[model samples]
Target chain A: MKFTINRSKFIKYLTDVQRAISSRTTIPVLTGVKITIDKDGLMLSGSDSDISIEIYIPVADESNQLEVIEEGGIVLPAKIFNEIVRKMSDETITIEVGENLQTSITSAKAAFNINSIDVESYPNFPVIDSNEVITLPTTLFKQVIQHTVIATSTQESRPILTGVNITIENGQLKAVATDSHRLSQRIIPIEVPESLKENSYKIIIPGKSLIELSKIVENQDTIEMMVTQNQVLFRAENLYFYSRLLEGYYPDTNRLIPANDSTKLTINANDLLQATDRASLLSHEGKNNVIKLTLTDDHVELSGNSPEIGTVEEALNYIEATGDPLVISFNPDYLKDALRTFGHQNVVIGFTAPIRPFTVVPADDNSDIAQSFIQLITPVRTY
Target chain B: MKFTINRSKFIKYLTDVQRAISSRTTIPVLTGVKITIDKDGLMLSGSDSDISIEIYIPVADESNQLEVIEEGGIVLPAKIFNEIVRKMSDETITIEVGENLQTSITSAKAAFNINSIDVESYPNFPVIDSNEVITLPTTLFKQVIQHTVIATSTQESRPILTGVNITIENGQLKAVATDSHRLSQRIIPIEVPESLKENSYKIIIPGKSLIELSKIVENQDTIEMMVTQNQVLFRAENLYFYSRLLEGYYPDTNRLIPANDSTKLTINANDLLQATDRASLLSHEGKNNVIKLTLTDDHVELSGNSPEIGTVEEALNYIEATGDPLVISFNPDYLKDALRTFGHQNVVIGFTAPIRPFTVVPADDNSDIAQSFIQLITPVRTY
Candidate 1:
């Protein structure tokens, strides 16, 4: 391939695609990025078996400053290619493929000839049909991903728990994730084409894939999501992201949350987060890393103690508290993560008992706390 | 131990002393920081045997906003104490030591009760007489440390090579360090007090200790240095930095540098640095990571090749070239490190042969290359 491209534009897209290339892949050719130049444009792709990212630069897009002198394809080592592109000083770089599958890259006064693998050695991008598509604004999709992905299990022993289940039920799009100890659910209303309303999607997408997709979808106003029985594709302008679906059935978590509350407290999210963060400092060296919270008529107190290190006590004046007075202990790290997901100024916390999980949601004057975004944390036994 | 001090002031001094506290030290008490409050001021100290840092905050120092209410001392766990001090929100924090070594730290709405060790359990700070001291501007001392510390050996097999050798001959002060592969030397002239004019000293200071001392001596006009038989003390204002000297005989590296040159090339330091940096990319993935340079009458070409990866060639226009045209191979990392040490815009490179070590010096029209500063790199036998 003999092509000249804008250095900055190429570098930006290459960086985005490089995130999908894993260094420890068993397939050696998967470590390299495939570059193809033809009459349409230049396509760069990278995959690590689980996820694949492809970016296209159209020939007619003058903003990218791309020129096609010849048409060919090659796969270059991703690590070295990324290093060279990031350090190139010239505005434009020219690349040409020659004998022995060697590619020459020249810019300003620097020229590099890198050995490349045959393009045929790369795995083919799986065919994904764009017939049934769900379209949403990039901003809304990003918000949903951030709200629930944090609760997914990092341990791969339970593969289903490592994914965030995205489902469409009765025209409502919701994403839920739980790692047994905590759960996060986000619900949003989206518009779907009338022809595809009969079909619903309940696919479990790995949390790691959604994190990478959110970063790659920047600069686009809207995203088109295409789902199949085994794969999911998200298209953002000239970029396409594909991820394999987790095969196991996700555990039903609806019955896990309690229906009634014994006590409820309304407090500022930032104040509670800071108090718990400080209290956790003393408890972190302990085995359980548990912090206790007690509510009284006038104030709420958070405390942590360790035998080796001493104790810490932080008190805050809650907005209001009703129902029975309560005392409970839980992992402060889980509570911290739950508090960070709330965008509202005040959060309503509900407790059934010290042994059962508690619920946290954005405080609303008129609506029920269960309808919108909710996070649940299972308290640890401190005794 | 029992005092209310400005939170920000305490945090700054605590951070400086915390660097000397190592988690892997065999002595358990060394993991804690000793805080002593007396009629004069408050002292914070931490040590890991190799280096000890002590910072004193006087009661009357308005800049530090310190106030001592009682006279006592105790040692608190360094890791937990540092974390708590960093997160304190109140303008002033009150710390009181109660019965059974229970220390209470209170600020605004946060309170922490931490266990502490008796002050007697902490090791005593070695007293070094200041009668024979060398005083120099902090800026100049920092420059000398930076110029030679990078060449010290990181491997501890030869403990002597891990320290920078400092020598004083007449009124000239010189520092040199080498890892056997490359050597860096810096020399400067300074005025000595008449009482110490007759004595010449040679000492080796651990490179790690000098690094920490450089950071602690910031914003000071002058620093007092006392070199004893086996230790060095650097006192900057209220901060005293003490480090044990490495005990061994330093090798004589003077004979390793060649006196004559077969080829001499004058080139822009930045241009040469950037070219070699790019050429090293392909070679970095190879076994030796060596880059070759060819000096012709017109230009200097830098090239690197890997049998599996391809090749890179970078050429730069030199200001001038004299002596025989030559080709040489060396580790690009060593050349990069040597070039980075030269603060001058242009440098003169001298090569005795393809297999011998080469010298790089600041470009001078009339002075000899060996006069001010010099760096030597041993070339690899590419043939």
Candidate 2:
């Protein structure tokens, strides 16, 4: 493409689209960033097999300092192009496609002529119904995804479990993720038009895609999402992020959470997190990676022991304790993750039995946000 | 051993000594830090076969924040102990050894009881003459090492090429390292006491050990060096860094550098560095990684090309160009290294024939410091 644009602006657009580019892609052309310059502006698109991103720089945007001298398209090697743009010291950089698919990039005293792939070989974008797009605040979207995405399974054996299942029903958006050992879920009250009130929607988005989407949409206020049968697109101001949807159904996890509890303990989140972290120091790998928690009348003891290494014990005074005194063992990493997901200052942990799963919720549930979030961890049987 | 020391001060000592510890050591005890608590204070030492570092915290040192309750010694696992000490919130941490090599680490409300190895199995320090030592400013020591260490061979085929050969004679300390493709040398003048004037010494210190020692001696003003038959110890105020010397004679690299030149180019160090970097973008790996430099009577041009990829060309105005116009090709990485190692603002490159190695020196070599540092890089035959 023949064009001249502000160097920093071009870099910003390149970085946004580069989030979806993978150097290890099986498709050779997927390693390039497709650049197109036409009547509208310059569009930079990058894709792995799983996700694709496109960021557009409109010619009318004065701050971008873009001027189109010729209309063309080219796919440049992602890594070399990125390096050249970053290392160029000039304020403005010019790119022109010459004979034999050779592209020359000139900036001040430096000029780079790199091979460009045919744009026709690039994959086409999936079709979507733009009229049925759903809009949500960027902040709420980022928060819900961050809290639940971490709990998703990393194994690809069960593809559905590797995604965060997002559902919209009764004017509320809920996101849940679980890897069987632990589960995290968050709900946000959203406003939808009356025409879509009776229609419920659920989509399982790959956790990995959500992480990349979060980084690209940081500066935007709202995002428009268009979901089709197989792919979902999240549109920001000048960026479009598309991810493939998992085909299988997500497991019904509502029945897994215990409804009643016999023992409860309220403690500071930081204190419990620290104690578990220290206890995990001695927990051996390839084993259960378990740490025990003993709740007594006056205090709680957290300890971890390894046959090869030694043991660690930490006792802390709880804010309040009730029900029968109990001892339980579980993977300390899961407990740490649960505590970290809770933004509240105090956490109230509920236990049904030593062998059963436990629930961690905010001690002060008066706030609307805290009332809608919950994290559950399944304990490991020490015996 | 039983002692309560200021947690932060203890952490500092542990960090310094921990640099010598490696998780991949074949010797089991080398992975553990030997901690000795006595009337003097606490001593922490770690070794990875190639190098060992010992840091002592004396009870009398100001702000060391140490107290000795009993006298004993034990070896603790480096990773676990470092983590426990770092995570403790208490200002003072008390460590007490119990029966059967069990250690109780108590800090505020937390206590960690960990396994400790028997101290008797740890390797003993090498014997050296305490009276005979060479001292130099830590800054000078750091500078000479940094300038030459990068040139050391990373391959294990020839073990001697991996070490930096340091020689002291005629009140001057000279350091040189080469990987056969490129070589770097630096010298610094110093005053030696009359008692040691007659003694001249040459030792090859492993480049990796010099890198670690440089980090530990950053805050110290002066360092004392003790060279024995097979080991060299770098001693700071309260720290001892011992590195095993590389045996066998070093190659005679003094004759490789050209003393006269038919062509010379004087250019800004940054300009040359940037041009070579851009040129390298198009230089393909495994295919020579070559970049060509064309020197004319007026301007210099740098260009690189790959058959599959394209080409890059950068032209820069030089301060001075003399002799005949020439076209030469060399690996850009080696040239970039030579220019980057020079501390001078501007670099003067001396060239003989296109096939001979070139010398990169400071353009303004009036100062004593500039005259002592020289770097040489071999050129690849382009034909």
Candidate 3:
């Protein structure tokens, strides 16, 4: 294989494909990025068993300035090849396969001759033969992923909880994730096919895959999603991302959210977030890493204490406080993560008891989209 | 003790002092910052035995807006205190010593009550009682430190090599550092005291201390340096930095520099630096981490090979390559560091033999200052 392209433009595509490659893969060939040059364009593929990414640079795009001297394929070591390309001292670079499977990469007066693996040894990406496709707005889908992925369990003890449960029905897409102690849910609207609109679909995608997909699809306006029995593909204009689906069933979290509250507090999310951060500083030095929030008819206060570090107390500024007085203790890091998703909007926190879970939702949310999002956290038993 | 000062300005002094405080110190009191408040202003001090820093915020400085309420002293935990002050929610923060050695730090509505240690337990900074002072230009001295510190040995095997030898005679101040394999030396003119003109001074300051002093002295125009029997004090307008002297005889490095060469290569420092960086990428993956430079009457080329990986070759662009044909191999990282000190200037590299140490100096160095700076690197024997 032989080809030359604009160095900077090629680096952009290479970085996207590299996100799917892992050096710790058991399959040695999986650590290599497969490169193919055809009459249409150049394609780079990388995978680590669970997730695969392929980006294409079309020859029709004049900016790429792609010149294909010969059409073929080869797999090079991803880590070193990327460093070589990044440090090359010219605006353009050329790569050619020589005798004995040796590849020469040249730019300016510098040349690097590296060993290459046979492209035929690389594993093939999973094929999705289903015609059913679901179109999603790039921005909205990214928001859904960011909001719920935080609640996904990072521990592998319960592998199913490490994935977000996504369900589509009646043109509304709902995503939920819970790690037993905390839960987050977001609903967004998407265009469902006529035949699939009548049939409901549910899939559990690993949180890591969703994060990588969100980053690569940032520039695209919309993404086309196709699902097979064991795999799902998210397609953009020039990129194809595939992820394996988790086989086990996701736990039901609807019953975990409280329907009523005995005490409520309304405050700006950013205001409470800063106060929690300050209190957390002390708690983090302590053994339990927990902070307490006390609500009364006349005042709202947050406090944290570490036996070795002393105590911190802050009289928080809140919009309103009603119902019964309550004191709740929880891991401050959880609340900090949940509050960040609400931005600067005012959020209403509902609490039923000090030992039970509490819910935080947008205070002035009246629209269907805003009302459909909620974050719940289970408080620690300080008593 | 009680005082209120501009939070941002106070933080600046706190950060400087905290640099001298280390949590890993054997003395627990050394982990705390000593704060002494008087009618004049507030003084913050921290020490890690090897290095000590004291910064005074005077009431006369309106920018500080420092208001002293009482005269007393206490030592607060450095790490947590700095964090609390940084995260406080007001433009000005008030710190007051309450009953029972508990200090209350208040800003806006947030309050943090932390335990404090008796100021008497903190060690006192060393007194450098020397009438002789050497005045050096801030920018020039900083440049001297940056150029020589890179050659200082990071390994503790040769403790004396970890410090830079600084000597002052007549009106010239010279600094030199070496790690056995490489050496860097720089000399600049400084104003000597009238009484000390006939007396010469030599001291070895730890490389780590010089790096920290350079960072904190960026805003000052000139710095006054005083040397005592066992300590050196770097005094600015409001800051005092004291470092312990390394007690050892520095080896004479002047005899190691070659007075003549059989081969020379002249090239832009940045151009060679970039090419060296590219070649080093492959050598770093190999066992020896060395790159080769071949110089002939017609061309100069650089190459690196890794038995398990591959090889890289580049024909260097040079202004001149003359004398006997030669091939030398050395660590690219050492050359890269030396080249960075020259910036974009054209440098003349002098070589004698394949395994002998070579020197790099400014090509067009006509000024005394430029001619006084030189970097030497010993080549490795590949055979």
Q: Which candidate do you rate higher for TM-score, 2 or 3? A: 3
Sorted into a CAPRI-style docking class, model 3 comes out as high
Ranking by TM-score: 3, 2, 1
Q: List-wise, what DockQ does each model earn?
A: 0.81, 0.81, 0.87
TM-score of each predicted structure versus truth: 0.97, 0.97, 0.99
lDDT for each candidate structure: 0.88, 0.87, 0.93
Model 1 residue B76 CA deviation in Å: 0.7
The DockQ-derived docking category for candidate 2 is: high
Locate the minimum summed-lDDT window of 10 residues in model 2 chain A: A364-373
In order, the candidates keep a fraction of the true contacts of: 0.84, 0.83, 0.80
After superposing candidate 3, which stretches have Cα over 4 Å from the reference? A369-371, B369-371
Q: How well is each residue in B1-383 modelled by candidate 3, as lDDT tens digits?
A: 99999999999999999999999999999999999989999999999999999998999999999999989999999999999999998999999999988999999999999998998988888888888888889999999999999999999999999999999998899999999999999988888878889989999999999999998875578999999999999999989999999998999999989988999999999999999999999999999999999997798999998876689999999999878899999999999999999999999999999999999998988866644899999999999
Candidate 1 lDDT for residue B285: 82
TM-score of chain B for predicted candidate 2:
0.96
Q: CA lDDT of A197 in candidate 1?
A: 85
